[model samples]
Target: MTRDNDTERRRPDVRTSLDQWLDSRRGVLRKGIAASTAFTLGASAATGAASAQQDAPFGAVEFQNQTSDGTTVVVDSAILERGGFVTIHDGRLFEGQVTGSVIGVSDYVEPGGADHLTIDLFDVPGAQFDQSQLQNTQPLVAMPH
Candidate 1:
């Protein structure tokens, strides 16, 4: 094949592959931005900084410590600046953080908030420790993600 023809053939293939890769990366970037925004806003809300700006990114989760059947958790409320989900984790505070496996997750919550939210529990796949160790008997931490 002529050098020009070979170059033309390779150009489209490379361009198409690059375009596909970029598209996938854009998706990942969008998701990462959303998550970071949520986490940042959630931190602000926790410190009472984002209470007035309802349109701004913010998240808050509130629930009382209680017992459960290891199958579900009740959150008094969950506030989110955008569409997202809330997760339940063991309330094992170590080094100022909840060092525990996910116990439950709520379905997609729309922008705004939900009252008396109920999250279904399940052993997260590939847990480092047995789920039962943190179930029923320990306090659970509800977080917005």
Candidate 2:
């Protein structure tokens, strides 16, 4: 009982300090996230600067995964570039379903290789976006989006 009371008293202080720290360090955190190239709704790409091909239109790069449940829609990139996002405010526009998105290219392991967008699908079973929702995607050159 005494330990519980003591912990309860300390919890508020811990939370307050944690909140303050997070508020002050939000930009750094966002930058880290952008660098990782895992963009979810409400999170913008502040680091990876993608410059797409001259004629390619700016759109969401999507992927489809065949899960046991059904097909899951995933958004991997902002068209051809890293920071090529049109906007991140409305998750719906990007088909950002309830689960959220963590984006990347499948072939980032190779320094100079074909770029295939890889998106980690979250909760929603139904969502839509660009590029035919390829089951077997073709590799694109590792060019800036």
lDDT of all predictions: 0.64, 0.34
Q: Model 1: residues >4 Å from true position, as ranges?
A: 1-56, 92-100, 123-129, 132-136
TM-score of each prediction? 0.51, 0.21
Best by TM-score: 1
True-vs-predicted CA distance for residue 144, candidate 1, Å: 1.0
Q: Which residue window of length 10 is worst by lDDT in model 2?
A: 84-93
Per residue, candidate 2 scores C-alpha lDDT tens digits across 1-145 of 6998988876767767777776664543433334234433224334323521222332333322323221232233334333443221123314533223322223222222223343332222364445333344332111122
Q: Candidate 2, which segments miss by more than 4 Å at Cα?
A: 12-14, 26-36, 40-145
The numbered model that scores best in lDDT is: 1
Q: Against the true structure, what is every candidate's RMSD?
A: 15.4, 15.5
